[model samples]
Target chain A: MTAILKMKGLGFSYGSRVVLNGLSLAVEEGEMMGLVGANGAGKTTLLRLVSGVLKPREGRVELAGVDLPGLRPRDRARLVAVVPQSPSAPQGFTALELVLMGRNPHLGLLQWEGPRDLEACRRAMELTLTWDLASRPLSSLSGGERQRVFIARALAQEGRLLLLDEPTAHLDIGYQPAILDMIEEIRKETRITVLAAMHDLTLAAQYCHRIAILHEGAIYALGKPGDVLTPENVSAAFGASVHIGEHPVYHTPVVLPLGRRGDDG
Target chain B: MGLARNRRPPREAVHPSPGARLLSLPYLSSHLAVALLALVVIVIVAGGIGSVYIPPLDMLKIVADKAPLLSLEHTWPESWDTIIWQIRFPRVILAVLVGGALAISGATYQGLFRNPIADPYLIGVASGAGLGATLLLVTELPIYSHGLSLLPIAAFAGGLLAVSIAYSIARQSGGLPLTTLILAGVAISSLASAAISLLIIRSDPDVRPVLAWLLGGFGGTQWRDVQIVLPYLVPGVVIMIAYSRILNLFQVDEDEARQLGVNVERTKLILIGAASLTTAAAVSVSGLIGFVGLIAPHAVRLIWRHDHRVLLPLSMMVGAGFLVLSDLVARTIVSPSELPVGVVTAFCGGPFFLYLLRRRGRVTL
Candidate 1:
């Protein structure tokens, strides 16, 4: 399969502080790619670069043989859907209203949403199991419910590339798997590419086709979950001691943390 | 990105209807209709009641007579026509336009800043305009020439300057923090208000007219005043309405808004400029009317959804009707002499504003 997203020597800096440097990778058209990193490991910064929200300071990205950052903001948005971590849920707005804003890229200047736009949103909400929360105010929803709503919004964007930053961070045990399974099902059906920044390595190992571990402004390891999620690699990336096991049903990696690497224990 | 791709639905399928799309919605239509009808009735009531007391039926006939090819036999007294047409209509129209201008501008600011409590008055926009108008009035510069009024121009420039200063001062490394923005606005407002006081004190004319204007009312408003405000108000309102959809995106996270195709900085500048212009135009005529902007948008948001496509128009309607009715009470409640319309608005609006603050405690940006 051909790579749909190509990043060549990408680098970024927030003023004098470099966040990600000399990052290069290719994402195939339809695979689910998990980005596993600890806090400040530059996962969010890299995702922002790929989504064209933050321009790369060193190199460039190309999506579908076109320069990503060179494209207009609306054109880039039409190609990428993002579920930002900890997005502010406007209290006065309802869940459906927030979800409908996903259609912003496709809409023309001054255009209101039509019946078809609403239909697209409804389909996304149904898939995410958030249709029931449509009329509820965002302020009243629990964190998990709001997280699902945000996911639904990303789904409603209907872009080819989906970038999710902590998509299931606030979700419970039941919802975590259910939402991941839904995303997997959709990706299989529609061939949409997913690049998700995940804090939980075990969850990443389960759903993602390939896992990339980012450490110190670069990818330390990138391979299939079985190859990349070994104990040494995980310990090195996160700087924490961890025992690696296998899932009973899926046979993917399951990481059991042994606490901080240099703690008293 | 591919010539052979078939991903998004065809553009025509998702295209919004060409005209008045919000009014045609099944759920919102009835409410919009009611608001619209209420505005019509309020206009008539506001226009009809004065010292002379022209009836609504006669007012309608007089208005119709002015229309070409609509010659109705005049059965009313001659002076009644002058009272209805010359004196009353202009004042009522001024009230409507100014109120609508303030409400829509307020909605624009509230959306752009993502602060529910934001308004023209709260952000020091009105004080700036008030200062501008005070400067013009005190200087006795020729305000009207070439069928345009320089008063709104001066006010618009001054208001825009003040808001830009406030916005820049409020800017942090991350973004515009709302608390800082409010603090800056308050600081700017006092400075401008102090400047106005100095100007009036130094000029030392009959301070009564300036004081009357400062307190805010529509007394002695001429047709020329309405003519002056339109050049700024109409375009300002149009720009805000056009930007309403984009403004909703601002309520979302700014980065997400950018990823969703909004030019965040550009949109911010445009909406701020438009809102300030509208506020300046309204203030130039109505002089420091407070809280109609705040209360009207709040009422619409409370009763209806917070979608700005719906919010903007409904707020304008509510504000127009509310101010016309307020003007009615201001002029007639005491009879002969009038209370400032701003006083009436503040009487109701002050508690409502307080209640909102107490409930929300801190409005997050």
Candidate 2:
């Protein structure tokens, strides 16, 4: 199977400080991978590079074996849809209208949203379980509801690759699991590969087929979540005494940090 | 959260009003019908009730005489003919064009800044035009010798220069930061204001003409003024409308817009250039007609939905109709002694603004 996305010898810098240097990664078809990182770990930057929102200072990024930057915006958009951390919807557009914007890449030069576009929007919303909220303004939705709406938009893009930056940043536990479940469902149903930045280690370990643990702008570990989220690696990365054991319910790796105590001489 | 807590429904269903619930997508016809009717009525009433007070019947006659298909021998009193033909019509047309220009410019600025209170003059256009007009007046450049010929060119040059400076300042690292543009505009406006004051202080005969122009009026708009404004207005309005697609993309975030196949930098440059040209053309002829710019778009958005495709074109028509009526009121309110059209617009716009604030708390700023 061809790699859907490949980054080779990539480098990025902000003035004197380098973010991603000589780092490379490839994602094959039909995989749901989680980008695990702490705050300021350059996970967002990496996703931006893949989304074509930022220019890579060195090396090449390819989508489906074709080089990036040469593809037209519409063409690239047709292949990869990105869900930003927190993107604002223009005030007063309903959830359906917002989702229909994803179909913009497939539109003809002078085309307005037609019956087919509306159908696509409805299907995406239905899949995300946001069809009931179709008429509500995006601003009126709860944080979890809004994230689903963003996901719905990505789904409506009909792209094979989806890039999500911190998709669960604002959700409570109930909603976080629901969102991850929805992403898993989407990947399975549509065969669309997902690369999502996730903050919750348990959620990442549970849902992601593979996880890349990113630290200080480079990948510290990339493999099955069982290997990557080990206790020693977790301690080294987050500087916390962590417990790594199977989840009580899901049988996935559960990371529990030790509370500060007086016995740690 | 607390406010909504107090207003919790008797039942927990999210649907508030089933009857008036918005459709999944808003359509144009129902939303625009009322505004269009009001605008039409306003234009008709305003066209008849100018300083000369041409009766509706006689006004129809004058129009009939001009119409090619209507072969009626419509005769009017000589004085009425001259006043209607030579004075009021051109003034009304100028009012329409000027008002349309300013309102559209204001709408563009509001969109560009993503702020409701943003005005066209936020970018130093007013001050730049003021400086150019003041210079012409103080130097006795013989520019304004033949009606309003030189005013547009001078004001256009000045406005373009100021915008170029603001644009340069706003661009720091290839991207145009909106906050930077606004700050630069403020600085540029202050500089132009200082220049104007200096010119006024050392003026021959106190430079009252420039001051009156700054205060704004439609006192002497004529056919010549119309001629000078048309070249800029037609092209500028066309370009603005053509770029309406880009404007829609602008409502999205900048990076997102770029990913949607818009070249953001090029679009901004085109929009800024067109808006500035329109402002210069209008300001040169009518001096500095104020609140028409700010109010027309607000009224359109308040009355209708917030789709710019409908909003932009309707705003133009509503703007034209509004200023014509305001100019008519300015002319006829005091009979032979007319108030400045700017004063009428401000008086009307102020109360409307206050009402908007009180009623629609979300839209005030």
Candidate 3:
């Protein structure tokens, strides 16, 4: 399979401190790639590098064989769309208005969103099941509803790749699996490449086609979910013990957190 | 944690047709029309009010007489025509220009900073211009101004300098936090204001001119002042309108806006430059008219919503109308003995802002 996203010797630092360094990975087209790591393990940093929010100080990032770092922001946005960990918009904007902003990159500076742009927004909103909420104020929506609306916005960008940072963050159990299911459903039809930072390792194991474990600013392990999510790897990367077992129905890894080296459990 | 996607059933045929968006179009335009109409009405009525109370209809005719297409019979005294054309009209037009410029500047700053309470006056641009005007006045600087006062050019440079300092002070790790920016602006405003006070005290034995500068009015306004303000105001407004879409994207968090392909840093710089230029031009002639900036845009947001496309123009019209009325009240409320126009705006705007702050703290910085 051709790789849709490729990173080689990527390095990013904040002042004297390093957030990601010498990181290299390739995500295949039509595949769901999950980035899993603990706090400060560089999961979000890697995603930001790909989305062009933060530039790599050292190496190259290419999306579909085109250089990402040098492209102007408007051009880069046409290639990839991102949903941040906690998505927010200013008050008084309706869901339709927020979704319409996804068309911004496609538009000229003075150009207004015409009928065709609205049609694209309509289709995107329909896929995410946020069509009915178009006229409603964004602040009036519930958490799950808001998540769907933001996903609709990302989808409306019409980018070739979708990057989601902490897709299940701030979501309840019922909504978490549903959002993943919906994303899978959307992917099945659209065939858009997805690279998501998953805070919940089990959800990552279930949803991602392949998983990578980020450790100390590099990919510590990369393979199929069942191969890469062994108990030893989780313990090493996270600095804690996890009892890894087979998920009964899906035959994926299910991780249960245990206390670290010396804890009062 | 995987489950069937059954949480939200496919919502019924609730997606409104394209007409849904098209429907809101007229609603916005009608409000815009109302604002435009209000401004026209206020300008005409305000021209008629003041020391000489000409009827609003006669004021309309006198204005129409100036237009080449129509010439009505000369009904009133020639001095009345002089008052309408030479004296009152120029002053009123200056108020309109100042008010509209200030409002647009306020709306632009608020959008860029992502705060509702943000305005050029609150963020030291006005203070900087005040200092610049004083510097020009005190030092009697020889500038090669052709038909333009040297004060506005100096004031523009000063205002730009102040905002640049505030922005740099607040910038951290390539991001400007709202709280830090506000604090930095407050500090800079204090410094510029102190300098202005010192210049006022030390430079001039007669305090009237300095008092006029501090109070901010169009008491002796001429058409030349209006002409000097135009070159700055026009291009600044065009840039603001051109960037309104990018400004909408900015309402989201910075990272998201960047991800959506907005060049955040460049847009911020251009918006700040244009807004400051506009603010300084208004301050140069009008002398720090207060709160028209804050009140006008917020009022527009109340009637319509936060879409800067409509917000910018409607705010301009509303601000122009509001200030013309305010100046009318300022000059006529005490009759012959007039209050400074800034006092009128401050008195009206101050309590209104306090009410906003108290009403569930809606007017947030």
Highest DockQ against the true fold, candidate: 3
Taking all chains together, each candidate's TM-score versus the true structure is 0.89, 0.91, 0.94
Clash pairs, model 1 backbone: none
Kindly report the docking quality category of candidate 1.
Answer: acceptable
* Model 2: CA > 4 A from native: A108-110, A262-265, B1-41, B144-148, B259-261, B362-365
| Per-residue lDDT of candidate 1, residues B1-365 (tens digit) | 12113223454433332221222366667777898898988888778898988788887888889999888998999998888778888889899998899899888888877777788777778788778878887886887668676766777667777888898998876456656777998999999999999999999668886787777999888898888789988888988988888888888878899888888767776777788878887887778888998989988887876888889989999999989988999999999989999999999899988887787686664
Model 2: per-residue Cα lDDT over B65-136, one tens digit each: 777777766466768777777777778888888888988888887776677778778888888988887888
Off by over 4 Å in 1: A260-265, B1-30, B137-153, B167-183, B200-206, B355-365
lDDT score of residue B286 within candidate 2: 82
Sort the predicted structures by TM-score, highest score first.
Answer: 3, 2, 1
- Give the per-residue lDDT of model 3 (tens digit) for B1-365: 22354435545664574433722557768887888888888999999988888998898888889898787999988999889889888999999999999999899988888888888776678888778877887776764466556766777778878888998998887666766777888999999999988887888687676677767888878888889899999999999989987899989988999999999888877888888889888887788788999999988887776889888888999889889989999889998887789999999899878877787466544
Please report how far candidate 2 places residue B121 from its true position, in Å.
Answer: 1.3
Model 1 C-alpha lDDT per residue in residues A110-196, reported as the tens digit of each score: 677887778887778766666767778889987767887887888888888999898888777877776677778778876899999
Residue pairs of candidate 3 with colliding backbone atoms: none
The DockQ value obtained for model 1 is 0.36
Instruction: TM-score winner between 1 and 3, please give it.
Output: 3
Q: On a 0 to 1 TM-score scale, where does candidate 3 land against the true structure?
A: 0.94
